[model samples]
Target: MTKPQGFVSKDRNLHVCKAEAAASASPADEQPLLGEPEQPKFLGIELVTLKKIIPLGLMFFCILFNYIILRDTKAVLSVTAQGSSAEIIPFSKTWVYLPMAIGFMLLYRKLANFLSKKALFYTVIVPFIAFFGAFGFVLYPLSNYIHPQEFADKLLNVLGPRFLGPCAILRIWSICLFYIMDELWGSVVIFVLFWGFATQITTVDDAKKFYLLFGLGANIALIFSGRTVKYFSMMRKILGRGVDGWAISLKAMMSIVVVMGLAICGLYWWVNTSVPLPTRSKKKEKLKMGIRRGA
Candidate 1:
C-alpha cells in the first residue's frame, strides 16, 4: 500500500537521488557563466579628419594666391593699357588663371602619394625656382618691350566679339601658362606636404582637433596677405613707377611665397621625421582578421 501520498520513500533513498541530479546540472549551468565577455575596441584612423584644416589652409592660400593674381593682373593690365584709348579690360588677358585651376587639381592628386620627405622637399623648391626663374629671365625682358597702347588696340581689333581669335587666344594661353608655372604648382606642393604630415602624425581623432588649429593659422595667413598687399603699395610709392615698380611687386610676392613654402616644408619634414606613427587599434586588427577570414 502507498504510505500517505506526500511521504518520502525512505527505503528508495529519494533525497540522495535528488542531490545527485542537482550536482549534475551545476556543471551545465557553469559552462555559459565561464565564457568571456567581449571587450570594446578603438576605431581605426582615417584621413577625413583633415577636412576642417584643409578649408582653412585653402582660405589663406586662396587669399595670398588671389592677391598675387590681382596685383599682377593690375600691373600687367596697366602696362598693356598705357597710352591706349581702349578701356583697359579688367581681365581681358587674365584667362590664364584657368590653367592654374586645372594644374592645382592635377598636381594635388600627384603630390598626395609621395612618401619620401626629401622628394616632397625638392618637389616644392624646384617649382618655385623654375617659376620665378622664367619670370625673371624671360617674362621680365619681354615686359620691357610691351607697348600697352599698341597691344590693346591690336588685341581689341582682332578679338572683336568672338573673343577666340589669334590675339585673344594667345593672351589667354599666356596667362594660363604664367599661372601654372608661378603659382599653382607651388601651392599644390605645399598643401600636399602639409596635409600629408598632418595625416601621418595624428590619429583620426586628434587630427580633427588640430586641423582646426591649422586652419586658424591659415586664416592668419589670409589676413597677413592683405597687409602684405598694402605694404607692396607703399613700396611702390617709394620705389617709383612703370614696369620696374610692377616687377618689384611681383618679386616681393614671389619671395614671400617662397619663404612660406620653405618654412612649411621645414616644418613638415620635422613633423614627419619626429612624430611616431599612431598605434594600431583593435578594430583595425579585427578588420584585418575579418579580411583574412573572408579571403
Candidate 2:
C-alpha cells in the first residue's frame, strides 16, 4: 500500500515539530506578531496633548507675568507713598487683603451658580485691568487731592505714633487699594481661574503629565517679568532727571499689563475654539470608562 497523506511516522514525530519549535521560541528570536503603533509626539508629549497644552501654557505665562509685575510694582507704590512705610504691609495683609479675599470667595461661590466660566473669567479679569489702568493713568495723577492727608494727620495725633501704620494706609488709600487688588490677582487668577480651568479640561492622566509643564511657563515668567521690573525701576536713571520717568515707567508697565491681559483673553478664546467641545466630552467619557474598568 502507498503511504497516506497527512500522516506522520514515529520517526518524524521523534524530531522537533515545526509548530512546537516556533511556540517554544523566545520573543526576542521572532518578529512582532503585529506592527507597533505609531504616535506623533514632540519632546515625549503627544502632538494632540501638546496642541491642547501650549495655548493654556501661554495663558498661564501671561497671567503669571502680570502677577509678578504687579507684585513688585505694588510693593514699591505702597511702601514709598506719602506717609506710608513697609509697616503698612502687615496691616494691609491682615485687615484689608484678608477681608477682600473672603468677600471674593463668597462672591465667587454665588457667581459659580449662574455664570459660565468664560463670563466669570472676563468679569473677574476686566475689572482688574480697569483698576490698574485707572490707577496708573487717571487716579495716581490726582493722588494729592484724593489722599486724605489732613484726616490721617489728625487721626495720627489722636491715636498717637502707635497708629502710624494704619494712618498711613488711610492716607494713601488709592495705593492701598492697588496693593489689595495686586494681592487678589495672585490668589484668584492663579488658584481659582487658571488651575480650575486647567483641571476641568484635562483628564487626570494628562494633568499628571502636563501640569508640571504648565508650571514651567510660570517659572519662565519670573525671569521675563523680573527683567521688566528692573528696567522700569531704573527708568529714572535711564531716562535722566526732570522727565517724570517714574510716571512714564508706570504707564509703560500698566500698558504692558493691559496688553498681557488681552493676550490672556485671546489665549483663553483660542483654547476654547481650538480644543473642540467633542474632544473634551470624549476625554471625560474615556476617563469615566477607565474608572469603571479599574473598579
Top lDDT hit: 2
lDDT of 1: 0.51
> What root-mean-square deviation over C-alphas does model 2 reach?
8.7
Best by TM-score: 2
Clashing residue pairs found in predicted model 1:
80-148, 96-175, 96-176
Candidate 2 segments whose C-alpha is farther than 4 A from its true place:
1-46, 277-295
Predicted structure 2, TM vs. truth: 0.78
- TM-score of every prediction relative to native: 0.52, 0.78
lDDT for residue 89 in candidate 1, whole number 0-100 = 36
lDDT of 2 by residue, 72-187 (tens): 99888987888888899999999889989878877776665577778988898889988988988988878999999999999999999988878898899999999999999998
